[model samples]
Target chain A: MSAPPLLEVDHLVMNYVTEKGDVSAVEDVSFTLHQGEALGLVGESGCGKTSIAMSLLRLQAENAVFKSGEIRLNGENLLALPEDEMRRHRWKDIAMVFQGAMNAWNPVYRVGDQIREALDLHFRPRLSDAEATERISRLFEMVGLNPAMANRYPHEFSGGMRQRAVIAMALSCDPSIIIADEPTTALDVIVQDQILQELKKIQRELGMAIIYISHDIAVIAEVTDTIGIMYAGKLVELGPTVEVFARPKHPYAYLLLSSTPSVTGPRRKLAPLEGEPPNLLNPPTGCRFHPRCPFATERCSIEEPPMETIADGHRVACWNWREVPVSIAQEARP
Target chain B: MTEPLVKVDRLTKLFPVSRGMFRRPVDFIHAVDGVSFEIAPGESLGLVGESGCGKTTTGRLLVKLMEATSGQILMHDDGSMIDVAHIGSDDLRRFRRRVQMIFQDPYESMNPRRTVFDTVSEPLAVQNIGSLREREDRVAQMLQLVGLTPPNTFLFRYPHELSGGQRQRVAIARALVLDPSFVVADEPTSMLDVSIRISIMELMLELADAFDVSYLYITHDLAVARYMCDRIAVMYLGKIVELGDTEEVLSNPLHPYTRALLSAVPVPDPTYRKPPVEIKGGITKAINPPTECRFIERCPWATDVCHSTEHPPLEDKGGGHFVACHLVEKGAG
Candidate 1:
């Protein structure tokens, strides 16, 4: 079932050196992404989902420090590469579509010219004006945007169209993987659905892996093939999206899924997870989620649980995974 | 059967867009164009739509935050109905005690310099209902009701010290301290994290029951609306398209726009595949919108009838479900 993983993240750890103390943003988290596979990392704010994405692209902030572990893209350690070599691999091998990036464009420049700049930088041999135009047009069509709208200013395009343009720019380099961080958080539901469908279609046709980082589990459930639930910088659970949604073993994962409200289901009483997320500056000794987990015991507070494989391709890091109820999926059905 | 608590009759709000040296009114944005609805005592009604669809404007109109261009906002006071839309400034101060609003962004709503006690007690002081010590007692009681435990600890803290969820609770406390009969909560939990959002919503539901209050819960998320509202009203470009029982309207959407919206919501189940959304383009500008059906530009089932005729009026379908689309026959659903 494995033809060598396309990207491997092994025991990655990162921290931010703030004035107060060292903020452990990312703990020992590991996951592998194969070619053409889609993975979703979902959690509340400050759960380190964005931190993981930044680490993969080596785009962390100036204060961030990688304490341990390795990120291997096609068997090459991205952390060990020189600055110039890593820059080459950024948009060419792994690209990113940021959250609310539709408004990130320079208002003074034409949208097409902005994309052309990316092609001029990352695309090899330098695309001529005509070639760059042709590439941008093709990319625009791939993302379901009209090629002619490229000349319009950023303010001229609607929110949905600008998002499509951003997606086109991400694919301008034809990267192997695209890391989209909350790609549709700002758009309306109808527009978000359209953009997600476009991304899924493009992923299938172009055979590129996608790592989606989002706080909305519903958005993640719709587009991802594999789901990884992050809590306090740790991957609490990792498995096929269907399996995890149907039979969540981790306490945090179970509470989160049940807490999310849905449009098409019976009106069940949502069980809200109590207590706030633990402060990362002075994190707890054992499991980060022990303070809010319903299944936490004395041992859970003292000893951190390791990721244990329970089913094929399903792993959960919980001392009492068996105690968590498995009836949410059935209860949600009409 | 029972006397309605608040009734809105054809409420409209137009913001003029002036240009040139004279600054003449060249155009107008019909932000809330002839919207109407009623909230029965203790009933929660959800106003839902995409951005720029006039949901927030309607909420603001009800609370008198913005004056309506022309309409009647009638609220029952002491067994008599009063037109709040045109209430004089003297009467407006008294009317404010009965109607309050909880804004969307907690970060911007509360004054950072003011302590929680000052914010919550300002309403009591403005009304001159209690002395300073009594105001403190009421604020403490309200904070405890909103789940900010150890109310004394939060009374003197400024807005910046509280978390997003706590700040929202304080906002809720401020809105409900006066025992308002009606509250308009505009997307109260949109800015909070998912884990914290559910708790805040549950707290609001609990407080509504304890206070015996009616709510016009304005939000963009249909799922959240279903949880917090007893009735759901779907709004398009400055008009109400559908309104009915939340489960009934969601399960059997009569209007095409409502159907498209329900389909577009991402279901949490990975096994579920939604039907393709049969709409085109995004929400259009409301400036000088055509007199014809506002949804014609994006509606998939727009016929010549939709184009030639005036904007359809909301007609009651069977069992209180109302729809405004020309194609939806009366009592269809």
Candidate 2:
């Protein structure tokens, strides 16, 4: 058997305690990221894509509570670790590039100094200030930002440059895994493409695992090795990127792939999935996607679908996915 | 040829910059600089570019959200041609009924406290065109038109109670309640989910047909523009560098900027990836830019003439396709 995955999240369930009641955000979410591989978590907003990413880092807000789950990094159960220990593990073992990180940097300090501070905070006592500065310069170079611009304030850099600075800070400690949540959503097309390519190149050179999260299917397809489709806090479809796009098994995945207009491909009439996403507060019974899924049946509403392996490394949670013919809209392969 | 619904000529908007505590004049930010386009009756035109490229500013200008520094916005409705740029407040109010706008963010556009009925009927109320009961009837009809079935069910619901897609539908209903001849939608579906974007887009097209509305659709998404617009205008730093039939411009681009933008957009297919083009330097600052091609510094095919000369005029090539690049002008591309 292959070695254990660099990061493994098993049966994770997260809930947020509100004034009204406890709201289940992510339920029974499980996935693994191998060494030097990338996994993309994709879904519409409030679908628990961000919740799962936050669960991995233990960064959920005070209102959030993990009912049951095991977050393992390099075979060690991170969930079982103490808060102080988990804090130390963060950035050293895994780092995150947040959504809107372009504006996340401190405006008062130099961009380089902020990166250096991350390095010092994580790897202090062993790494001197001079050493941290050197690493910060190298990190900036890796992310395609000029080391000379490190002294410049956040306000001085463009949106793309600011994002690059954020990436540099994420890599300050040489973390084994990086979780990027919608890193390029706000960027222009050219800048977005450049950043995606840079991240891919950096991943190759460093041999680090990445969990890229985005709502844009095309953006996720471009960078991720494996794609995990989420809906209402459930992992609907988990499979290789090519297979998921080319031959989607789940109805939600198929609908998502077909609805989005492609920059390249023969234009077809997009048969949009009808109805809004189900309210997560009081989600639909059984399959969360059954409300909008065209192929849903009587059995689908009464009993929850089990995640079964249909092919090698491809898992789908649906009762009638087999009976449901892979529609022409989805098979418009390039 | 029939008169176009809207015509913009030499449209420009410069925002004054103040400096120091005394608030002395510093410089101007050319948000929309010498831009011009037109939408024929019942035609859809797309204005596409990167963020801060003045696509939104152009849309706002057409709707008279901000007065232009200089230009002519001539609205030809029925037979009368009214100059929108210089219209008085009273005339502006009358002009607003003919042209309306759908904002980008549905969350922020509609009032959180207002019910769906109130939100959709607000435009009719502002125009003072009907009684309260008549406005309610119109709002219900619009809700059904936008596919919010059993309009009574959603009539009293607040924005917070609806999903992103539902909120956008309500927003669209409000924009169309006035029965405007023209609508300017600024990235209307960018905030919605990918799975539901096409549904909203199709709904808009369907409504356009039913209402006989012309659209000035502004978005950064090329694929969406291709699907929605008959003609597309590629903007760069407040100037339209290319404008043509959507299929013609996309399949066979003339301008270098257009080509770069097309290549950079991420395609859904994983098997094919366009090799990244070397887009040197940063976005051209719109404030006091050099008197050259706005895309000169980053353009790979730029020559000395591109930098030292006046801004290239958008010259018509064959078949109504217009391009502003000198390379394209010389037939070198």
Candidate 3:
């Protein structure tokens, strides 16, 4: 636990400029991931979980403006890097497996050829066709896919196999950090389970850091070591997955957990949070969640709460963290 | 025993599949192959399966949205059995009011150009029910019933103006405007966020209780099915492999497919982790599949006889719990 972190993002703020106005997609978010660690960014849609992932690799859209922040990978500040330098760092230093990545491949091209193209484009002086093919084969095998199926088009592969191929392509450059954004969101339960297990296994084998982003709480809990709960472009809570899920310090975190129905354990009424997510265009004053939070008081509506460490590696940004009841006694902590 | 409101007896639907350069009809996909189930008045039956399992097709069949290849869909009304599958076009119009459908994607279901008032009132207009003022009153009542408060305010808003959850509620209002006896909902909450999805589900349950309506809820998620259904039917490759009480099917899954499905769902809790049941091979083509089990290719317990024989019949395992597996009947699986 004393080793230096592999990736550290501090006070990151990213805004999207539209004709209407400027929308703060990600605001003052901070987190760190150690080597071989898996951190999950869990939240609802428009919560800026995807914005945080995009900012890591500098993949935001044209209108996105980075007002302030520092993203460091292995002591190198990524934000300060030149465009060409950052482009070089992509895929080789930090690779991303995008959402619905199975369909991201060119339907007409062979899976093997597509992966080899990534290697030849990213690395200078280029790997030979034969060398790239060999590398792709090894990557495929590592992702629990047969190297023989490399010549087949994406249409021939099943949903799970196509996802595996996507993962294999991400690993083709041997990146130290992998950022997966909802890799299993569209898949069936069985296929999703297999893909998550394989991803965890590959992360362990390669000793690579992973930033897993997903909207599903259960899916995040399955593979993530640390879980960061985001709401309205802010990290509401960050802690070990077990501690955060079992005993959530933030009220938003607690409400989100209770809202999701569980497959295991006894059944109970889902405690749905009241009202819609706060509008990012005109977000509520003070705490972003104060409008929907049941425990919001006068202070909660006037002043934003800073992230405070309540326990080892557990941080929550709530003015009244102590007032957040431990009503979730049913789920035993790991 | 009282007569069930809706009963499906071996309902089947087939679509011809064409391939190769000839573009000839090579085979037919058994989209809904001999699916049979019953829903009593005010009871909710969940039909759950993965994509391409024909769960949505089954829902479409119930409302006669698509013509079934064969089999009986009987609707018991005032002590008379009306065969829904064989009904005429004139009678079908009347039958539509009794059986309504709620589609999955609210974004596509409603026209963006039309206001909420037009969308919800179309069904009444088609049925030629009441005057203009009466229809408006009815639509207002339905909107309020579905929890769209201050219905007048939302009646003029287009679908594009509403959030995902609001659009779904609008769809629900449209479906329930006719006050149907049986409703077929196909993944109505799947498109909404988790927090909003729960609220929509709760609202659905509340409306069902108030209206005394029976629901044929279709979804690919087991957790949502368990929360919404009284009984669950596990489908695979266009056939119901297992059916039983929601608790029984989830806690004590008899079929291997159901067991694998339960274990596959990532439970939110970290302490309770179950190793996923490994099923070899992917789902086979439903077109011209072997007469044997449709799940044979992916089933771990498949044997030589399983490949040669026809798919097993739904055998009652007591308490109305049924399973279709050759090995389970032989006490080996």
Candidate 4:
């Protein structure tokens, strides 16, 4: 409890040098993750969720450039840290699980060796191959993967197993934080669920902070302690998971919860959003969500609303979010 | 139901493996194996399954886009039944108008270069309909149907100019421009965002009711299937293992595969403590597959009788509920 929360971002504004010129990717985005908390960053594809994740660890692509912001890991300024100095903090302090990174391992190398390389490089630089192998087995065991199968090549394992291998690699350094972006995309639902459960168990036992980014609301709803809604390049809303799900203040938040298809809870079909996401390079003026918002007013098109605190734990950024009814969505297509 | 609009009987599509100069067929992958179903007029039936299952193949086969290796496809045309399987290429043109498909990826399915007007109007031109003026009117009408306001403003816009949900609307408008009676929507909302996905589904439902269109909705998302489908068919590796009322099949999935699939969906509740069953391996390879139950390798309840032979024929368990499994077969016997 004396230690700072795992990660914190204050007014993070990340930009990209695209052909269309510099465009904002994460504008005025801010959030925090406590020890052992799972924060779900939910949004459509290209909604800056990944960009914010990338900026957190300074792993952004060449075209991307951090405009202005403070990304602090345990009260340490991640942005101002020297590249060589940052290396010391990377992986050991915080780790990342890239989107669809199950196949990230070299196909030719045995998965055991891949995990061993991480441990040898990061921690125990003087570790012998035998010692590294033992550490790899521990990491594998920690992730609920059979330690015996670590010697098999990547192709030998199933998609779910490959993802578990990746997760095992992420936990190799015993990092306090893990950023997983669409980890279960390649696997089937059953396998996805199994992997998710394994991930949850790992989070619980190790007491590490997890940042889960996904386009699927159901997955976010299940795994996350808190949820954040992003659009274009702005964090539109943020709150406790149950609070956001129970009383979504942003129209976009309501849209995400309503549109998500749920099997057991409700007897309604998902109402598809009427339009596609706006082009990020030249996102719609005013609020980025205005063009697609059913409750868009004239002011919503002309002026962007600053994210406002609606309740003790709930926040929203929309001019006409109040216009949306509190009654749960009932427009099931007849 | 006055003889289902489209009746598929024992439809099977086999893909042959080729090799040497002779290309002697050593094996066949039964993508769709003897599947039978009916789409009643103005009714929506969901074909739910995981990827690599025969759901999409079955949908394609219904449109005659892929020729079946065996079985018959019958379409009722003005009280006269015509076997679509035997229809010639020339005659199939008219059938194509009546049966159109909304592909899974709207981005890939459409010509990104073509304007929205051109995309919607292309179908009218293909069927050799009215002159340019009349076709434009029809294109405008299609845009209005999909809820794209100021149709003329959209006329000059290309597919890239539209969003995922809008492109899907344009895709739907193209399919319905010909006033098709049957539509095969294959995961139409998978690529769109959650917010957009819901609205598009509602739009499709609206089109179905207003146009009196029957739908064979192919999707892996069970919740969407349950919401829109009057009845559902659960497919696994080229077989319909369960078929029945949407609510019954989802709430009480008799087939182990169906139950597992339903359980896998992550409900929007933090306190929900349902642990998902572990599916140990990937779908089994279907190379020169056997006549026995394909799900035996993965099924939790597999026994000697389940694997010894072709397990169970599809048995109707009252109220039109149908399941093809040895457990159901033994219980009924």
Candidate 5:
């Protein structure tokens, strides 16, 4: 009952300065993950989902500015920490399994070297070559890879194995939280499921909080304890995984849920967001989702809806969260 | 059924992989080996497999871009039979008009300098369809047909001026402008988003139905293959391991390669819970290709017979479902 929560973010905002103007990529987004918990951040492309994940570790590009936010990892404020101290926390405290795992692992290095690099970067351990090799084999075993494949380069492995190698590298440090950004997006369905299962099994055994980022809501629903839907740099909906999917109060959340092909139900003819994602440089006034939202009224166009708790622990940003209409609820799924 | 639009038999293409200085004699990758298939009038055949399985190479062979090392392609047009593979350079022009290929990445394929009008009209111009004004009209119509609104506005715009979906639409417009009876779409929608992917597929299907077009849809994604194809051929390495109706292949896959591949695809389903079979090892390099099954090295169910002997020829498992596997044959032996 007294175990500390793993990772927490409060009012995180990231803006990029372009030749055009300063644009907010993520605005005032906040979520919490307890130890061993997983949070899935889902939305369409250009919805700033990746930006939020990138901001967690100050991994955003030079142009990106963190206007305001508090990111605490096990009671330590990650954002406020010095660069040298943050570098210490990066691999040893919080590690990331990047997207396009095949390309993320260095081609020049053997799979074992890649994993060992993570250990050497942070731990600076005093161990013999034999012990270091044993530790690398252990990392491989945990991620369901053969111990012999340590000698192979990234190119020698297939898409799925390369992904497992990346996971192995991420786990080498035994970090408190693992942030995987679209780790399986480039892989096929079967391989994706394989990787997801491996991730879930490891998360369960290691008891590390995982932040999963994806544009596909269905994938997010599978691994997440809680779900957050981002739209145009805004966290428009946040709730329990099942609640947000089953009964999404926000219009954007409902749209995202219905659009995905559900294995159980009929294939819903994806009603894509009505309009193009806002130009971050010239973002729409008020509720950023209003331009594409069918339920948008004069109030929505003029005044931004503050994030409000519409249900038990479920927050939504909508002027009329109770009155919003979902067309699919009444229509036959395509 | 209406004399089948196109037929390929024993099509093979071998690329000699360089093995440094003093390489062995005539070593081949077996990019495509004795692969044969047919497309009936207006039918869609989806070719599916993982990367480097040679799905794209097979598509290229169909259009005569790369001449098959050995095989015959029987193409019927105006009630005349002509061998597509042995066609002289002179006749390739006529055959080109009847078949077109939709490339995978739209961002790179289309010329950035050309306007949408010029991109779609280039093929028509090659055929010497009509004057400049006439070709422009046709290009605009094609754009409109692909659901790009205000088609006239897109005519003067360059590729950089459009979104990914729009650029792909323009690419699709170029493919269909020739009114080809046979089209090879090589992962046309892989570069697109999920929501736009279905729309593009629906658009392609509708146009095919309207124009009696047959498609050789090549992709690695099975979910999309199931949605867009009437029949599907699952490939392993360079050879087809299974071919059958899409539904049958998805629900009752026979070949171990097909079973492993289908079992691996992770469709976005929160409730989808399947114990994944640990596919051991990695893909084998297709260098100096052997006679045995290429998948035998990694397949868990592989036996000694599968490793030394060639896989049994594609056997009919009824209802036009064909599979090539020694294990399947032994089960029904």
Candidate 6:
């Protein structure tokens, strides 16, 4: 617990500039990733979860601009580093398993060859042909894929297999951190479960830090050790996964958790959070969730709430966090 | 119990796969292989399965969007059952008045050029049930019923003008304008955002009661199915492996495939740990599928009995809980 964090994101703010206007995609977000820790960012669509992931890797789109704050890996600030210097850090220090990564491979190239390409680019002191083959095979095996299938093209593999290959490619560089964005969104439930278990197994074995970004809270709850809930562009809540799921402090977090339907447990009428997410281009002043929050007051619309710690490693950014129900089960009753 | 609203008997649909230089039909994909179920009046039935499992195809077949290769789709008419599977184009038009479909993607299902009024009133115009003025009133009423208040605002708007949730509401309005007795909604809210999805589902439930309509709601998410369906049918590789009351099927899954599927669903409780899924690999191509068990390739409990015999027949174990598995004995869990 005394070790310094592996990655520190200090008050990160990002925007997408367009002719229409600037979209405030990420607003004053701050978090840290310790070595071997698994954290999940859960939110609805367009809540800037992906924006944060892209910011971590400096892979934001051409129009994306970082307004302020820093992304520090170890003691070095990634934002201040030169483009060439940053390029060297990519994959070598931090790799990403992109959203909808099942189709990440080029159709024409063999799966093994595509993974080898990553090794050829980032893995220095160059591996010999035999050594590279051994490493690629090992990578495939590590991801629960048959190493023999690596010679097959992407088109030949199933959706689950392709996803495994994508994970293998991400780990080929042996990065200390892996940022997975909706890694299993397209696969079936069974396949998704298998892939998630495989990712957890790989993370545990390699002792690599992982940042999982997903819209599905259920998937996040199962895999992540810690959870961060994003609303509009802000991280509204950060806590241990069990603590957050058991007692969500932020109203947005509480409503989102209650709205999700579960296969197990008593079937309760899911209370849908009313209204759509706010437009980032002209988001509501003060609390971004104020417009849709049932507990919002005039003061809430005028003053933004700062993240406040209420328990060990549990923080909530809402003026009415105390008023928010302690548990979803109590609210479900009439 | 009241007479069922619709009964699907041994419904099957096969798409031929062509290969070789001459492009000959060498094989057939058994999309819906001898599937059967019933929808009660004012009841909702959920058909859930993984992609390419023919849940969508079954929905399309029920609404007569696609012709079935074989089987009977019987609908209760004024006094007797009518075989809708082979209804001629003339009778098909009349049958269409009683049944309507809501597609998965509201964004793509609606034509961009058509206004909301045009889309919702088309059914009334096609059925010739009301005059032009009456059709306009009916469309407005349907829009209000689907929770799109101030219907005048959305009446003339094109598809592109509405948000995703509003578009789906418009789609619902269009489907319900004719007051169809039965509806086949194929993954209606799957495309919407998570928060928006629940509202749409609740709206559908409210409309079902208001209109007194039955629905064959097809989806892959069991949680959504559990919410919307009174009874559930689990499909796999063109077969219904399990069918029962939604609570019964989910609480006590009998088939190995169903058990695996139920176990794989990630519950939202971080403290809850599901048993490990016992299946292996993903759904295989159904082209010229073997006559044996459809789930044999992945079922962990598959034995020689599963391979030697023909595909297991769906039989009620107890209290209308049906399963199609060789190992699951009668009267057993």
Best by lDDT: 1
How many angstroms is residue B176 displaced in model 1 relative to the true structure, after the best TM-score fit?
0.9
Of candidate 1 chain B, the 10-residue stretch with the lowest lDDT total is B17-26
lDDT of 2 by residue, B236-284 (tens): 9989999988988888788888988998888887777686666765576
Candidate 5's displacement at residue A319, Å, is 4.3
> What are the per-residue Cα lDDT tens digits for candidate 6 across A257-326?
8889889888888888898999899999999999999999998999999999999889899999999987
Model 2: runs farther than 4 Å from truth?
A327-334, B21-26, B330-333
Per-residue CA lDDT of model 5 for B126-188, tens digit only, reads 888989989988998899999888898888999999887788889889988989888999999
lDDT of 5 by residue, A81-127 (tens): 88888888887778888877568777898989877767877776555
lDDT string, candidate 3, A1-334, tens digits: 8999989998999999988898988989999999999999999999999988998999888999999989999889998999999998899989999998998889999999999888987977799878877888899889999999999999989888999999999998889999999999988888888889899999998899999999999988889899999999999999999899889989999888887877678787777788899778778889999999998999999999999999999999999989887866354312
- Using DockQ as the measure, name the better of candidate 3 and candidate 5: 3
Accuracy of chain B in candidate 6 (TM-score): 0.98
- State residue A272's C-alpha deviation in candidate 4, in Å: 5.4
Alpha-carbon lDDT of model 2: 0.88
Two-chain DockQ for each candidate model: 0.89, 0.77, 0.75, 0.64, 0.32, 0.89
Compose the digit string of candidate 4's lDDT tens values, residues B17-73.
886668789888888888888878998999998878888989998888888999998
Colliding residue pairs in candidate 6 = none
Which residue segments of model 4 deviate by more than 4 Å? A1-3, A269-312, A318-327, A330-334, B19-23, B329-333
Interface Cα RMSD for candidate 2? 1.0
lDDT of each: 0.93, 0.88, 0.89, 0.84, 0.81, 0.92
For candidate 4, write residues A1-334 as lDDT tens digits.
3566778898898889988787778888988888998999988878999988888788888888777789988788899999987887778888999888997889999999888777877885567878778888888888778899898999988778889999999998989999999988777787888889889999999988999999888899889989998888899999998888887888888877776766776576454565567777787889988998999989989998998888876789998778876844756544
Off by over 4 Å in 5: A1-4, A101-114, A124-131, A148-159, A188-191, A216-218, A247-249, A261-275, A319-334, B21-25, B303-309, B329-333
Per-residue lDDT tens digits for candidate 6, residues B31-123, read 999999999999999999999999999999999889999999999877778798768888888788889999999989999999999999888
Residue B38, candidate 1: Cα error in Å is 0.6
Question: Per-residue lDDT tens digits of candidate 2, residues A1-334?
Answer: 2987888899998889888787778988998899999999999998999988887888988899889988898888988888999999898888999999889888999988888777768775768767777787788899998898998999999999999989998988889999999999989899898999999999999999999999988898899899999998999999999888888889888878878887676767777888878766788898988888899999889899988999999999999888655653734422
Ranking by lDDT: 1, 6, 3, 2, 4, 5
Superposing every Cα of model 2 onto the true structure, what RMSD results? 2.2
Worst 10 residues of 6 chain A by lDDT: A325-334
Chain B, candidate 3: TM?
0.95
